[model samples]
Target chain A: MMKYYYDLMSQPSRACYIFLKKNKIPFTPCPLRITKGEHRSEEYTKINPFQLVPAIEHNGFNLTESVAILRYLCREFPHVGEEWYPSDSKIQARIDEYMEWQHLNTRMQLAMYFQTKFIIPKMTGTEPDMKTVERSQDRMETILDQFEEIWLDNRPYVAGDKITVADIVAICELEQPSMAGYDVTEGRPKLAEYMKRVKKHLQPEYDEAFEQVYRVRGRFWGGENAPHSKL
Target chain B: MMKYYYDLMSQPSRACYIFLKKNKIPFTPCPLRITKGEHRSEEYTKINPFQLVPAIEHNGFNLTESVAILRYLCREFPHVGEEWYPSDSKIQARIDEYMEWQHLNTRMQLAMYFQTKFIIPKMTGTEPDMKTVERSQDRMETILDQFEEIWLDNRPYVAGDKITVADIVAICELEQPSMAGYDVTEGRPKLAEYMKRVKKHLQPEYDEAFEQVYRVRGRFWGGENAPHSKL
Candidate 1:
């Protein structure tokens, strides 16, 4: 049996978790709470030197990085719908383009917004810096515009008409800041439609993965070390 | 012929340029000079919404992001040998791991070092702030340590004994700072040896792609813009 290590609070980990479950890949879910610093424990570090989430241990082959794990799973379990990772060379390239671009565009940009607006200040019980929050929000808005105009652009999905890992990964990052009470897809019809399509397509797994993250938004609203929101 | 849009000064651009050339993939080199602000042109903007280098247009399919382009080229031209991408699923996953991890770890970190230590100061005609430079350099060094100790761990190549696209992308980013007369490989025997191995494997194409980036080191040594030193 494969051992999957993750914390849903992590945007990338959600992608991996959703991917594995959606594909019906049997694996043990080993939740490592990032807020508890469990990810940095010596044991976890032995699994992933970077001490980040979305790592898997299968038959002694350990791997980290959500995109890598996703791609590996696609190959390791081809019985799953090919739309998630497509078999055609051209379509795979398109999916690869999105996966690669989102690292900086969708993922990192939103993480900046979430960390500045919520994570750092809440975790430490300090007042969130308005200036930092405003700056990140501004950056997020610009990137979201790019996401809407360039990426969505009336396309049914990020890759094409079907929901793929690219859409799953994109939705995970886009929704990460919702843990801070911010929705980047707000007011963007194309993105919102895309989100709706993704949400409906992913169904209960989508809600289940994001439920804890959204619950976290309430836990730290007024700061002052709140009980760890059961993720 | 495929169309390649690039600027040698752009780190990611170098990766795509080298991969395409090394594999003998036919592409019309369309160099976009970042120093001259050519990449921000409206025409180029239509091609890449992010307006970044290392984009490709092939059979009406346009793609940005060097990793995507490299993977696409590998798939579109499988005759280039499986070692660059690998026919084995596990090996491909390892390469994907490196490519994904490198975005935040290797690429962004090195770009920060080069930008703060060189580009920002030179472009603005302002004195390079030692504090900022030191901070970025510190970050760069830490990630390099990660790359060496955790990543390499004395492996002959990034993904294993054979060379892969991961090596190509990593080498481009590692060499990016040499334009500032700085070598991250310096004082690190393992990284230095890894660079030697990559360079030897890549051969003349490696030197050819990095030519202009290496030449830029000579143009602004004393904080003044010198004539473009021929690469």
Candidate 2:
């Protein structure tokens, strides 16, 4: 059996979690509480030297990196959906292009914004520097513009009309800022609609995976009364 | 014929260039001088709306992003070597892990350092902020440590015993800071040896592809007498 390690708070972990649930792949769930430093334990180091979550242990093979884990699972499991990761070389390359581009763009920008505004402050029990938060927000806006203009222009999904793993990973990143009470889809109808479509397509898995994020926000910003009460 | 568009100055572009050459994939070279703003031109946007290089146009299928281009080329062309991207599922996943990990870690850190210390200063004809350069260098050092400890520990290559596309991409990124006269291999015998092995194995192709980078470094730092005179 495959052992999947993750934390719901992590954007990529949720992506992997949704992928697993949607694919119906059987795995042993090893949820690590990142805030409690479960990932930093010496034992986890043997599994992933990097000490990051969203790792997998299949049989005896160990693999880290969420995107790699997703790819590996698709290849290893016969039942995994092709619509998410098509075997067609060109379509797969298109998906690969978005995945590669997002690492330093969508993933980095939204993550920085979320951490600067929410996670870091909550963890340290201190106020975040306003200047740094503004800078992160500014950088994130540029990335969002690019995401809208370049990736999502006149397209229903990031890679193409059909939903792929790119959409899953992208939505996961885009939602991180929302946990900080930031409205990322504000003023961007294309993105707003895209998110709705993605959520609708992924259905129960999307809502189920993001429930923890919503709960976290509710706790941080006062239950059910926060600006982004629902994602 | 496949149309390859790139600017050798960009790290990923050089990675793709080396892969194509080493794999003996035939393509028409459409070199874009990024410094001259060729990549940003309206004409090039049609080829890659993101306006970045290391793109490809094969059978009217246009694609961007260097990593994706390399993967596509490997799959599209049978003459491409298997050792660089093995057919073994586990080995490919291992390579995938590094490629995914490098984006925010190795690629971002080194590129930031290089840009802060060398490229931006040269482009603006202004002295770089020492504090920013130092911060970038500090971040890069941490990534270098991870690269040595996690990836290269007790192994000759990044993925395993044989050289892979990950090694090519890794060396390209690790060499960027050197252009600014920083010895990244200092105090790290493992990384130094790993780089040497990668360069030796890829040889001629590695040196050939990096010639432009060496020229850029030499021009910026002054002839062969300048520090890091040759990569």
Candidate 3:
């Protein structure tokens, strides 16, 4: 039996969760709450020395990093839909290009913006640094523009017409800024439409994973249950 | 004909160059001098929208990002040795894991340190900022520790006993800081031995690609012929 360890709030964790759920890959869900430092426990360290979320164990083979896990699953289980990873070398290369590029670009910038705006502030009990926040926002803006002009470029999805794990990983990372009350899709129609398509394609799983994220957002950003909520 | 665009100065570019030469993969080399701003030329944008070094064009297909390019080459040329990428799903996953983890941790920190200590100072005609340089060095130290403790914990190679692309990519990234006069392998015996093995395995091509890099290092850092050299 495969065992997956993750927390929904972490972007890569959310990505893995959504991928596993959508693909219906059977595995034990081992959810770790990063907010409480559960990921740093000595026991979990044995599973993933990095102590990062979205790790898995199958037949005693442990793995970390979402990209590796996704690729491993696709290869290990041939039943994983071809549309998600695809078998064609060229098309798969396009998807691989996005996946590799996103680590330093899309994922890094958005996560930085979100962390500077919300997580850091909350953890430190201090206001966010305006200069650092603005710089990250600028970077995030540039990355979003690239997504629109370079990756999307009027295509229905990131790699091509069909949604791949690259799209899944991207959308999860993009969603991080929302918790900080930043709407990344506000000025970019291409990105906005692409996000909608990705969301619709993932269906209940998308909404399911994001529900926990948005609830945390609601409590922190005063969306609905601000007064009574305690995350 | 497959066209590979790269600059030996860039780590990923050197990795791709070495891989191609070592594997005997036929490619038309399109070397671009990043220092000359050749990569950012309008003509190059058609090949890679990001105007980045280490891209490839093959069969009317364009791909950027080193990891993608390497994987594509492995798949496209089935004759390429399996040890580089490994057809076995588990070993491949291990290679993929290191490849993915290095982007943000190993590559980012080492590149940040190199840029802060050497590249930025050269471009601006100013001394390196000690504070930022120290911070990046600290981060680089942590990443190196992880490399030794987590990845290379007794394994002859990064993924396993056999040399893989992951080791190639890692060694190239690790070499960047040397230009800034940082000896990353100084305190780590395992890393030093691992580096030696990777170099020996790749042989003359490793020495070939690095000759240009070492030349650049010597020119700036006062090696032989420093007075007359202009990079």
Summarize candidate 2's per-residue lDDT along B171-213 as a digit string, tens digits: 9998887778777787888888888888888889988888887
Of models 1 and 2, which has the larger DockQ?
A: 2
Q: Which scores higher on TM-score, 1 or 2?
A: 2
Among all candidates shown, the one with the greatest lDDT: 3
DockQ of each two-chain model:
0.84, 0.88, 0.91
Q: Write the per-residue lDDT of candidate 1 for residues B1-231, one digit (tens) a residue.
A: 889999887778888887877777889989988778888999988778788897998888888888888888877888974858988988998999999999888999899988898889988999889999999999999999999998898588889988888998898888777776676766777988888888888889887876676566665442443222212
Please tell me how candidate 3 rates in CAPRI terms: high
Residue pairs whose backbone atoms clash in candidate 2: none
TM-score of each: 0.93, 0.95, 0.95
Off by over 4 Å in 2: A221-231, B219-231
True contacts kept of each: 0.93, 0.93, 0.98
Prediction-by-prediction clash tally: 0, 0, 0
What lDDT does the true structure give each of the candidates? 0.83, 0.87, 0.89
Candidate 3 chain B, poorest ten consecutive residues by summed lDDT? B222-231
